[model samples]
Target chain A: MRIERNGAIAALHGHCRVEDAETLAALLWEGSVTTLDLSGCDSLHGAVVQAILAFQPSVVGSPGDEFLKQHLVPALARRATAD
Target chain B: MIDELLAQFLIEGREQALEAGADLAALQRGPADPARLDRCFRAVHTLKGSADLLGLTPMGRVLHAAEDVLGRLRGGQGEGGDFSVLLEVADQVERWLDDLDTVGVLPESASAASQALIARLAGDGAAPQVAAADDWDGASAFPGRAGVAIRYRPRADGYFAGDDPIAIIKAVPDLAQLRVSLAEPVADPALYDPFRCTLVIEALSTAALPAVETALRLVRDQVALATLRAAEAFAPAGVEVETARRTLRIDAARVDQLADLSDQLVVAKGGLIELAAQAERGGDGQALGQALRAKQAELDRLVAALHTTVGQARMTPLAPLLGRFPRLVREIAATLGKPAALEIEGGEVEVDKAVVDGLFEPLLHLLRNALDHGVERPEARTAAGKPAQALVRLSARTVGDQAVIEVVDDGAGVDPARVRDRAVARGLIDATSAEAMSDAALVDLIFLPGFSTAETVSSVSGRGVGMDAVRAAVTRLGGRVEIDSRPGLGTTVRLALPIRMVLAKLLVVESAGERFGLPLDGVAEIARVPADRIFPIRAGRAFVLRDEVVPLVDLAQALGAEAGPSSDRVVVAGVGGEPVGFAVDAVVERIDAVVRPMAGLLAGARGVSGSTLTADGSVMLVLDLAELLA
Candidate 1:
């Protein structure tokens, strides 16, 4: 798991498996106005996806994986807008 | 406040999680049931969603894995697999949930445990992969089986919506085939948008559309499922989802609140009756007094009806408690190396949830005792001309307002001679009385405290308790536990418990102008006999009622009140198979009253279970019949 901050947004990087879910949640919770970047990731576990869905952060980038981008990215973006 | 909400979540989530496991066990016992399976699936999904929304990462991971297992189960995989793993996972989630609620974080082992369970759910040898079958031409993966075809175009960024299309697709109860087509034209590898899913998916599934739609409920609009013409024409096993819901869950606090209010209403209504009586005596406004009497009657009827309604709401079917016995007996039998089979009867009997919950420990103790000492070794049983496998029967049925639960084991029965010898040796009973006791009385001595027949205290029943403890618990709940044994046949323990707590039928009796209420459930009969019928016995006084000898006691003396006139009325109460009579000054009318439980110092007082307000404003103490007789 990797966490990077750029001003108000905290961008998540690397493959976030079940083990990384808690840490990812902690970083997002601790930071304000955070956004998720899935462009550099390989796969996101259900927990990570849950974290994204719950946090509802703006997506500055998208993952290369078709399933992640088309399904997960839109799901996350809709929530971010709705919230 | 967050901690409290999390605590409530933990409690509800844990219950739902266990129910999910029970649902799977039901599925394993029957043919394919898409509806029941879906119900189980929904439970896990709700738990997972709640955990994620609450930012409970550890809980989310655990439930997500359980959800996956349910999905595969919906796919008709691991149909006959033991659901112990699911229960264990749910139990672990509860433990971690408790940790999270208390310490605001999960323990170190949470993630590892979740990962392990996830792997187990996914480790079912090979997950059946349905090959894409298009056009339904001459070749088909699932030749003759009828299936619905689904065209799924998930939201462009469904992953962000917390939608896992792949997981949903895998969850379809019965998947026959899958064909994926890219919705857009192919782009160069360098310019490919890997983050976006642009697939137009189509699938032929043996599962019903309702099952598929429910599985993809979050993305219901994305999936278009239809029955294949050929398969539908040949096979008519079209599964129609049944939304027949049986039970509605109500918070226990709410039910208790209603019952408590009804009880208070009953007490308050008594004050109104007293006012009406005063009005009648005053002889002013006779018409108003008549109207007050009519209104009081109506209020009494409504109050009684409301009390009954609240009591029914507090009642829950005994299925859940009985459902756990199969697994319990199996595990206990295995551990004890005893070949015992558990046979349950009348599990559909419903009773107060509090009563059922209170029964768990005592029933568990009896079951363990049956397995440990009651059930004999297979070889020993065969030699004794009995079946090799011992049978343990647990049954519950409502006998009037009481639930009579019995546990019977077909094993080596208790030896009365041994019990008599043990009682004498333990100084519980003198040798002379032990020698003079009948076989049944000797066996009854086993219920005495500090009694154990085990040569070496076994771990199962060696918890420094005995049948006496079981009896004590049952007595505390205003129930009776009776033990019966035949020297070589078997032992049967019957627990008869009241079904509710609201209204108790009491037979009011007076002692020195003070009234006492005796619960009518335990009263066998009220007898009036002349002085000639009474005979002097060694204990006190004895009377023969239809050839049965009953010992009698004076209610005034027993209650430590002032002595009253010689009473002719005898309120005979049941004490196991025997009847004991309490002579009171007068036998008043039988009426229903809301018995208030004794609290504070009175809680520990013997022979008084509760008290009820009389119509005359004074309190009438309800005697604990069993305790008084004991």
Candidate 2:
């Protein structure tokens, strides 16, 4: 329920936990989801952060959670920019 | 020969480490000073040379990697490199020196520690056990850096046992970094078990060792906690040796001035000796006495100059103490996931070494509190029409003879109402008194012992001691701390400390037939009020002084001594912007004395700042009226 895929963009909402990591990873692994919109994300579990780190997807929209917005989002953005 | 060389190496190594660390911190603060960068590079290079000379291979390896990184930094390359890792390398080297000084050799773990540090400095993105999951065994995942490194490999049946590995790792206090990977690669896709939990969770927590251990207690067998040899982890509560080094480097000019004063004193002594011989010969006694008086005056002048020169030699710039905070601030901010930047000013301002040394713990606590409780999260900050990145300024400046240090944060200023509620809930004050207290007084309640507004105890700042400890430490340094909060605007905590601790002007007063010294700077004025002018106010008493009713506290009663008849002498002192009068037996003469901080069993005695010996050789306890009234 936390991950909604529409076309090539997948939007994550609320708190993304370990259970959503599999769906999110599968969506990214299938080579269809190119962008992740995290504007509505309140927080992310460790597994969720790890999946994002591993997949190296293009991230868009800042999360509402301070940790994700300040640390995780910037990290993801840095990698994307580097690529 | 080797012992002497080792001693010299330890001293020089510590100096180079401090120099490099401070310069690196300065460079990280932007507009990178080329001179500082070059100096840092050279310092590291020198340290590397010494390490090699001493055959400290592990230290040499780490320093060589650091030197290379600094080399890149100097060449205007590798701008993306993390300065915190470099700072860690410097800290690790300093810790090794400490070990070498104490144990005569680096610990056996130094090699492994150096490798981890070298990997971090190499910018390889793969520290031994940090990111390289392939090499991780179920056991032996030593900490790659400071703080507690944890490896959690939940059993395959962990899912069935209702164990949530991710949640367990998430619950760790002050979790700085987390990495997840598969425990074992699946040989075949067909053989993969859907319900099996093969997740390996590795995390670095800034929490203390016991806290991490307790968090992983349930999965103790499946978890491994390795505490890295970190400066903070080892010291935990005070400044590290690099910042609080006892050895002082005084300017040659000051030493020359001191030598001149000593030479003048010697000449003055010769004059006195000639006058003494003239008196003994019974030749013109009056002229001999006049000559002796003149000689004594000259000696006094020379001694005063000498005393001042020595105090100047003891003066140390605030940079060494304040420089280390930027890296620590970054670490704490990263750990808390807060977007905060620390701007330091007046690092060049000089203060007595004692003041600088005693200030580190309190300043660190204040910064921690600012990041942990003062700064709002990015979302919250943005919603409040503020910048996502919070700004905390650590500044110092001289005000008159006092050094004023301030920690100002543009974050969610403390809510006095919430503080009042917490104070009442914690039984620090009655509900009626809390409601009657002013907003400023309500905010000041945060400094009351055992008072904390933190909803949950975070490892960052909520480790039993609260703002009260900060207040105590500052007061112990002959300083007074004040906090000003503007609801949602911001908060500023200011500490006004004496520039020098060697000499203090104290107003001697007698209470209960025993004499005490009160810092004259804190004493506003002395007044004598007739009994008719004093009237009972609230539970105590007050007197009208120039149309202002200042509350009165009997000195004897405040110090737990039996009160004699209340005298008319009232000494008014400022406490949190209000005048409070202390009635003592009599107003004695003011004298300039050196007040030594109390030690031994009397160190923690309440209401006493320090002790000073009187001209009669009697020890007088200096009363901290502000603390006593509080």
Candidate 3:
């Protein structure tokens, strides 16, 4: 995986559980997270969506779990790559 | 001081007289027996003596007149047609005594009313023939001569005023013997009117037939005279037989003292038994011989039985306690401006004297509460389509060695919803907790201190003291308070009190490495559990018994005792209906011990009722399970 540091861009990664997604969301709220990839992550459930809404209400994604990779991660990655 | 106690005794005495008089009045519907008539007179005589000591002069005079008239009736006085007046006199004396009981002194009005009743009886002018007629029995007992007897009954009103009927019988010439019989008034002192007399008299006279006729003729309106033939008077006679027939009357205090002394003797006998057992177990030849040779032990056994019999004879019915309620309800109704009827059943149930004495205040509170709060206003009842007059019923009965007193009222019942709202408003219960509670649980909250849902505070009730104090009073005696109410129907409060508190049974258990007793009523079951049966469901949580998850707290951890694990029973029980499981070091055998209340500072401690001395002389603390569970 190729990743950008503090500005939020990241390459594809493996699967993560719903609980891990929640932990990731909490970390993103603290401004330490920039971008992520989930090419192999699988166990993530609606809890990840809940964690996002709970921590960063303004953040959104397309309708399904795929939306997390297509929109959320890329959105962060673009911001990081530009930075 | 003796006089005051005597007055108190008289207060009860007049009541008994009235009850007896009522029986006589009922008997008047038929022929009356002379022995029963004599027994009735003694009851009145006792009333007179006690009343006199208390300086209740008017009441004393009333009873004296009654005693005289009843004497004539026993002497075979004229036809027993005039007993109605004697019953009426008893009714009046009971009323006066009742008045003295309530106001602490009889008012002047009572004396004057009594005088009027006596005057009415005197005007009926019953002859003073009791003593004269009794003379005939005495004279005829001598031989073949026929003797004349006279009887007298005063009027129902003022039977004591200026009427020395007994003195009159004494005045008859040539009288051989005289006896006055008085019967107790049948009126309940609570409902007695102070102007009635209940007396009958009989007199014996032996003179020429003309002389007997002439004496009867002098007070024809006041006395009834009859000629008793010699055979009727002398038929049954013998000194030893008469002595055997007589009952020896003794003081109640003496009987009580004998009973107390007997109890001590029994305890000593038990000690002797222990000593004998020790002698038998050990091959102690001298000790065993001494134990066998003790004749004093046999004497003690006989004395103990005698004392027991004397003590039992002192026991009267619970009627006296139940008797006070009718008058109480009457007074409460008048004060509350409500129409109410109090019905008491099983008044004849017998209870220990000490229990009856302690029951007064608790029963009073229950009755007052029912009257002041439980019953609704007349209009409320009318609107609800119930009887305008509400009914309050008190029933008491003995079950095994326990007495159950039920105070029930058919009136407005307690509303749990209102109680819940009040509790939330008062911050006693949070809204969520209140919502989660059942109606029964919510209603029970009323017994908590300072909890009331009363819309208004009246002098009679609703100042927020609530039933907490009442519950404390009952539990202090190791009794339970149970309340069941249905809105718009009625409420019943049942108090389950031990027949006597001297002896108690408790379950001994070791909690926190210390021996403690859990009252038997609170112990549900004791079960042994394996270590593997317990499992942690949460970080600091575990379940103890079957699948139903019980929050586990180590006895040592919860009570700050030494926590050393060993195989022991996981005692499972519910306090106040909440499931609780606590481990104990061991469950000692059940035992019977006298419940000794904890002393001074420890008396108020939670979860401990008192301490008891075990057979081995070790102190065991009695745990109050309800308080612990709460």
| Predicted model with the maximum TM-score | 2
Least lDDT summed over 10 consecutive residues: which range in candidate 2 chain B? B232-241
Q: How do the residues B466-516 of candidate 1 rate in per-residue lDDT, one tens digit apiece?
A: 677677667646577888887568889999988875557788888778778
- Alpha-carbon shift of residue A74 in model 3 (angstroms): 99
Task: Write the residue-wise lDDT of candidate 2 on B263-311 in tens digits.
Answer: 8988888887778778888998778778878887888888888988898
What tens-digit string does per-residue lDDT give for candidate 3 at B449-499? 557667875644444335765665566555667889988989999988766
Ranking by TM-score: 2, 1, 3
How does model 1 fare in lDDT?
0.67
Compute each candidate's TM-score over C-alphas. Answer: 0.37, 0.43, 0.36
User: What would the C-alpha RMSD of candidate 3 be, to one decimal place?
Assistant: 40.8
Please list the C-alpha lDDT of all candidates, in the order they appear: 0.67, 0.76, 0.60
Candidate 3's TM-score on the B chain = 0.40
